[model samples]
Target chain A: MKLTRRKRNMALITMTPLVDVMMILLVFFMVTSTYLDLDMMPMVQSESEGVAAPADPAPTLLIRITASGEARLRGQPLTAQSLASALASQPRARVLILPSGGANVQALVSAIETATKAGAENLRVVRLEAAE
Target chain B: MKLKRRTQPPPQETIVSLIDVIFFLLVFFMLVGRMDATAPFEVSPPVSAAGESLPKGGTTIAVAENGALALDGEAIERPALLAHIADLLSKKPGLFVRINAHGEARLTNLLPLVTALERAGVGDVVLVITPNPA
Candidate 1:
């Protein structure tokens, strides 16, 4: 009796289909994700612009509220009672309340109420355009 | 002596399984994706330079911290907001509607209010903001 010898064949695999599927998924996610623009908020300047400036200056009654809940009027800090007292001196017909950023809403409301109580007829909240 | 040749089994392919894994991943992301979900209706808006100084002579609407709606500080219901705006518009054809929404307020709540203002025929709508303190 004689011994027999044999040779075995090798196998090959292709990955073209897998790559195609992954590419499709990457495209889908790229389209769906919401891109937040951090710079969307415009910067407000302390001074008013000449082009959009109103002729009469509108007798604005500026109010500033800090993040810590402090309230001020035209740079002068005031309590709720004092706010009403200061408003009483101005003509209430055209009063603008400009609250600084991070101001407390409760304080802002209180200021609005005080202004209204002081007989402010036309109260406009001022939103200045972003400085160029 | 005698010699013999042997045939090998075909290689196993996994293209279909790979595609399945990719599909599952896609579905997972889709399910967990964040849709237009914004913060709750209680934000104090930061001052922006993009917002124009409100033009003269418009009706003012205020959104309070507790989500109460007010027109000129008078409490008004959501249903009545449109009517109030409409009535105001009848008196002044070019009535501007200024929205003073709190910073904590949700954008979702504010959008519907803006749509109502548009329906009420407000030509100019201004969003009021408070500037950051020094």
Candidate 2:
């Protein structure tokens, strides 16, 4: 006499737990993420392609930013039109932005914006070191 | 004659489509979002028109309006922060350092910190700025 054994059915895998985990992660990322449009300005670049010097000593234009965030050119307040016209006359002039230590970052950025808009190609921010 | 009423079986609700949708959403959030450690204090970066696009991967140092300092979302003192940065620089000489300073922060607080970082042998340093101010 020959004896035959019965086959056992396989267990079913549930996908509910996986779906729950994915949903949790989605919500967590959505809540914690901030959508800010950010940009960068290089503070220190080791390998700078130094700009070549002009044939003659380049004339420099000094723009002073006061503690109140006012930008002055030649002791006059900065105006976009006046600055553009002045730059148009001497296009090769290097612009030096001398900001007071008390001034905010916005003030420095605003002054740089004005200078760039006025077609100043060679621009530099002059940092002040406190005398010890 | 008596007519018997016949009932049809209910349609099956397939969860495959639900899983597919959730998977896509999960991948979307993971790919698009930058998982950066936020600063403990509020920092509104200065607005700039000429700033270039920032690349991923770096250590972030936050500067508050009152000259407070934070590194990677934890508030830290200047000396400790510099010492920590020095240690990182020794391990990885080319570590990119990002300074996320508040818009109203004085340059006195910002410039000196940058000078110290440079003195600590930081090869590349970038300032974080916002293209659009809200």
Candidate 3:
């Protein structure tokens, strides 16, 4: 008896399921993810990353943030113009921000922003610790 | 008279292009959108034009306006949070931490946390902010 071999047909793979899965994932990301334009201020940095302190200490300018969210420098309301004028005389002056515990985060950020706009190179935030 | 009938071949609907478009869209979303877990409570970061662009890959701690805290999207107490972070720091000494605190959060809530984080051996810590107030 002679056996006959049957020819095989090429199989077609469907892509509908793949497209469906991808579309679902795309929608999920679009719906659940937030697109915030975030920025960051360094609160702590490694010692190696920090700039070396000057051999001779620069003059320090203290800016205080009041409880009412007002920034004061030398008994005057702190403004960009005032800060710039103050930094003009001493460009390398160390600008220290001492924020009141009652002050909100916005006040601190605003003070930092003002100082940065006024060309402050040596900036530091002084934290007040309770005495034991 | 008898008329001859002609049958035209049906048009083929190609699905390969559709698959390509969907795959591209999937890849775009995956690349552009961050998968960070958001905090349960509302946290509006302080606005600051002086801030630098935030680098990615850090443990995020969210502080709400009422001084509530959440670490990596899980609501946690201060001591517990600090303990957890200390453990993480023990494993990875170079752990980076990002604080996403609300603008209305008092300095009492923020400053102390920062000091504590520093004490916990976190060398790199950043405060998250937004350049756009809106």
Candidate 4:
């Protein structure tokens, strides 16, 4: 009499470890990541399109922002409407926003918003460097 | 003779579907979330409506509300930060720098650093702003 051998079943790989690893990674990213809606304002420009203030120069409008977030143009507090009307008169004027160093970032941003709404095509933020 | 009863196989819950979901979620976060190094301190960027869409892939310098500085997540003194930036510029002249200044941070803290960066030979620099005010 010949003895018959039983068939062996192949081992199945377990997915429990894979699932655990993935769950851990997902939580790590979700907890560590910050989702902030961000925008940019150019500070140091490399482009050559903006020529240096011409010798003759176009009409220039100086808007100064103080520490209290007040935008003063020619000693008057500037509103968007006022700035727009002023810009309308001199469409080609160069608008310069000079912000005091003591002012907060919000003050500078608000001043910039007013200038853009006023339709000033050539806007620049002038920074004064301290003497070494 | 006794009749034999057939044993029904217990239904197996498919883990493949769960894996597929987890895979997609991981990809979703990896794509949408920015991997910029956060500053040691809290830094909330200023809000602006006229800001342009920010481009990615640049060194981020975070400025906290009290003027604390962090370059690519490492808190550093101003001189050291500028020196490192200057070294980077010497290697790559057209390096782009992004200044993530806190909304409440004074211009004094932000502007001087920017000026130093410019003089350090960095050609392009930008200030980070939030479209939606926090």
By lDDT, the best candidate is 3
What TM-score would chain A of each candidate receive against the reference chain A? 0.42, 0.84, 0.86, 0.84
Of candidates 2 and 1, the better by lDDT: 2
Stretches > 4 Å off in candidate 4: A1-9, A48-50, B1-8
Candidate 3's residue-wise lDDT over A10-110, tens digit each? 89777888888888988898888788889999998877345777799899999999999899999999998898899998877889999999999999999
Candidate 2's docking class is medium
DockQ score of the complex predicted as candidate 2:
0.72
Number of clashes in every candidate structure? 19, 0, 0, 0
Residue pairs in candidate 2 whose N, alpha carbon or C atoms collide under 3 angstroms: none
Model 3 spans > 4 angstroms off:
A48-55, A130-132, B1-8
Ranking by DockQ: 3, 4, 2, 1
lDDT of 3 at B47: 88
Q: All candidates: CA RMSD in angstroms?
A: 18.3, 2.5, 2.6, 3.7
Model 3 residue B17 lDDT score = 89
Could you tell me every candidate's TM-score relative to the true structure?
A: 0.34, 0.89, 0.91, 0.89
**Which candidate, 1 or 4, has the higher TM-score?**
4
DockQ values for all predictions? Answer: 0.06, 0.72, 0.77, 0.72
Q: Tens-digit lDDT track for model 1 on A12-83? A: 666776678686886687587763321111112222223475557655666665656565776777555565
